[model samples]
Target: MESLQALQDFIKTKDNFRNFVNSSEVPSVCKTEPCMLGVDEAGRGPVLGPMVYGVAYCPLSQTSVLKDLGCADSKALTEEKRDDIFRKMLTEEASLNNVGWAAEIISPNYISNSMYRRAKHSLNEVSMNSAIDLIKKVAESGANITEVYVDTVGPPEKYQAKLSEIYPNYKITVAKKADSIYPIVSAASIVAKVTRDHALKVWQFKEGLEMTHAEFGSGYPGDPLTKKFIREQVDYVFGYPMLVRFSWSTAELMLQDKAATCTFEEIDDELPKKKVKSISSFFSVKSEDGAMKRKRHKFFEERYLSMDNAFE
Candidate 1:
């Protein structure tokens, strides 16, 4: 982030956005250097603001640059400490010249929409797709990518196999806690955390709510302030604003308990269904294809045809 004013100015009504940083900081010749990229994310477990996916890459031979910049376990760092490290990366010559970073700010609305889709896209899928896109974007821009390291909570084998299939040329490594083990992934995590922090810091409400992030706590469902917000700042009809991931059970359950009674009518609009033939149709008639031929109702006509006498 450039400045508080700049971050505030960057806020938009759009659900998601992306930013690339330090692209020009690296010399053009560095593009030919064997690049190793790292991927990580922030706010995945939060119900507030946006979940940010960040990718950081540099020449494989320049691995020492990240270490020198103190790119280590982000979870071990204080918020202020993380901010200082990111600022140094942006302002320092040695760090800036060696690193290129990009981030995808996946909005809560996007998450809700994806998870609520007819087919339902899982959050892991969305995160993986974002990471994949970032990697491909950097490679397409002419970085000589050789190895990719990813930080993930899910099974590493599946994710590694998926990425290997996509970028078969690159050596892919997806592991649990790569952020703590790989400096590049740590750097990416710092970038993601800072980006998401700023996103929440400058979150603009379109729902006319007069509150701030301080009142919403850390966006974790367990956060006292977040639970308070879900219970207190709800609309009778819409529940929370677009900033909240409605698909999350925390928000949904809160809304159901505290907000208005909401009901949904599932519209089965798929060609009025196939109209499965009744079991009796099998015995009634058969078509040329040896299946039931749906016939018109004939209960009254059949009753009259079966009568022995008209009076009886």
Candidate 2:
């Protein structure tokens, strides 16, 4: 109860926060012993809330400690179960003496800004960078990190190579389903999932929505409640509050069709040019009726179905 209250109180104190972190105080736990660390993330797909990255570490020889605590794939556990495990990690001396953890919550507003930047940083880059930062933080805090395991959705070769290049002293392995296979990764997953769940649970809407997060559902685009919120709670001009990732196509399409079109920046006046009789300009520019009528050539179309548009 004290830990949960402390978390909520920390959440409430930030007024202009874009990104924030929660970290352990580098407990004197096995400080001189080599350790293994794991990294995982949650809420990457949700469009309505902050995404969280978490890392957990413990002495290399204390693998049994985590096993005894029932650290398993977070997806396989109920929310209540995950919460119980995390709470145990906080309150139990055996667990606390062997484990240390940290988390970073990347705000939706920050995600939207990165995606909409002039140079446009892709979400994958943003996520990878966050993971790297967390691992680096753990290592720099005097943890003798000898190995790292990461859970990934993309191919593992590139991510493994990057981390290995930076921390060659550590054995870095990036793999799909790692959270299920690795106890440390599973611990990280629990931390991430619980943090994300609570973040949405205690969300304080700056825009003053009268509904709870339960009413908005899980924030997945397919969730009927989330779809309803995106479609019905729109602000028309400002769109949904900053809680929503404005760059998501779900929100973009909604704004394009249902709300006034909005742009982030101002543009200079159009350049003067001699009138030409070219016919392709009609296909390239907006029509006189203010509609984009040119259908993309059937063969030369975008072949992917992903929202990470910043990545080219």
Candidate 3:
């Protein structure tokens, strides 16, 4: 029995070791060719927060190291785990450089349109521009970048066109799930999410908003709490705070409601005498058959009757 138990323990340990080895093995998806950059964005849907765009670059030689770092899609990881991995990539990994573009206080009205539209107009543009800028800087410093992959916000073709216009020298590929397919984009996503989350926390505290049980996770328009807060702020006439985006539909709704409540009156230099036409004379008209047809309209009478009743 003791010998059997020892054998079982040895097998279990060996199996565990094998599992670790498999987990640590670099993913085979990364191209062996040198020079690829990954790009992604976050906070595109948030009603209260800024849109964040991120970009990360990795040389071909370090692709295996990044894969071994367990880099995957940021959406697959918890906030804590993402932060941990992001920090590890930044410090321990030599090939990755992550950068972010944040647009603060984007209006709720903008969110009513498609998120992809907003991302394309704002975050995507900023991120791509910044990424190109970084690539140019790196190239000037003698670093060669052969290719870039962006997790497309809008159609893949649109991103491809934009990147082509921006960076004519390098090859750019825009795909729907580049974050999952490319480790560099995943790394950028991790950094972007972490940065945005931190910014949201700081904004919450600064705005005197309670974060506890707030359910304001990311503050997207879909969040009930965000909608409620928007309605309350607008209804309370908080004077369009800087934290709130004036371009959002929430703000427009509030403005419309305010407009509707205002009373309007006209001023005149002189009062005109009321003209009254006899109902019988007004209704008397000749028909096609030459017989007088009397048509009595009750709408005016009913309105006058209601006014009389109110006065009484």
Q: What is the Cα-based TM-score of model 1? A: 0.80
Residue 230's lDDT within candidate 2 is 93
Question: Each candidate: what lDDT?
Answer: 0.79, 0.83, 0.55
TM-scores, one per candidate: 0.80, 0.82, 0.57
Candidate 1 total steric clashes: 0
Name the regions of candidate 1 deviating beyond 4 angstroms. Answer: 1-8, 12-29, 92-96, 265-312
lDDT of 3 by residue, 65-180 (tens): 56666678989988778766655543423333222111122222343332346354554454455555544554444445677887887689987997788789888988998899
1-312 per-residue lDDT for model 1 (tens digits):
344345445555343333323222444545878988889999999887788888788888888888877888777888888877676655545345578777788878889989999999999999899899988878878777899999985799999999999999999999999999999999999878877887787777877777777878889888988888877877877788887899999888888887789567777764467878778766775669877565645985776554457566
lDDT of 2 at 287: 67
Q: What would the TM-score be for candidate 3 when compared with the true structure?
A: 0.57
Candidate 2 residue lDDT tens string, 170-271: 999899999999999999999898888888777778887778879998888999999999989888677888779988999888888888875665333355
Give lDDT: candidate 2, residue 308. 69
CA error at residue 70 for candidate 1, angstroms:
0.7
